[model samples]
Target: MNRLPRLRGQLFERHEITVEKDIVRARQAVGRAMDGLGAKAIRKTRLVTAASEIFRNGLNYGGGAVALIHCDAGNRMVWVDCIDDGPGIEDMALALRDGYTSGTGLGRGLGGAKRLVDEFDIVSEPGVGTHVRLAGRA
Candidate 1:
């Protein structure tokens, strides 16, 4: 139920997530951005993993999605927003819990992503769409 803010900072890359390949591109984009920001290896990996999970969720559950990568030079942070127009989650709390999945996966996408990032926010409206933001320090 936490609302994600509008994408801010310098948007270095934008990718449309319509297929499996797009997810890889998004992850690579994020990784490169983190590298450019001088993020530590663990931090870069965590952020990329978080971004990939959200991208996969958008593609598999949201039907498709888009990833916008942003860099906050002042804060030395990199973040990504993954958005989709699929049916919004009906139970936000339940969805955030581990071991609770609406799909065939292990039910750790959202929660695992959250643990891997420095900042996490998600907003979804039933019948509307879902927006997930993941951020990490560089």
Candidate 2:
């Protein structure tokens, strides 16, 4: 497997969330990494959904590529950043609206994802692509 290096802290390992079977792989990796790291069922589920949302959005809206970098933030918190280099969002506010969709999706992805995480940051430019970082206590 032509894979990226896995980063680990204690029993936790970080991974890149991409397409194919890697999304499932990444979810399992996260579950293993957060087990007993104070990751509650609700928070873990939320983070997983948030992770899935960003990856799908990156493939659909971005340039068919996305990078999800996960790491331990010490103190039982895990941080993940979903980065992409594609034509960026045209309007941030509009894009974040509950029922906004640039494609055929239901349009609730970004907004719903925001509700699932403790911290959410999205940055993009017309030609610069998009980067979304999500952090939460697991």
**Candidate achieving the largest TM-score:** 1
Q: TM-score of each candidate?
A: 0.96, 0.80
lDDT of each: 0.94, 0.69
The global Cα lDDT (0 to 1) of model 1 is 0.94
Clashes of 1: 0
Clashes of each: 0, 1
Model 1 spans > 4 angstroms off: 1-3
lDDT of 2 by residue, 7-105 (tens): 343434444544656666665665555565668888888887887787778767775554454556465666565666778888999999998999998
Residue pairs with backbone atoms closer than 3 Å in model 1 (clashes): none
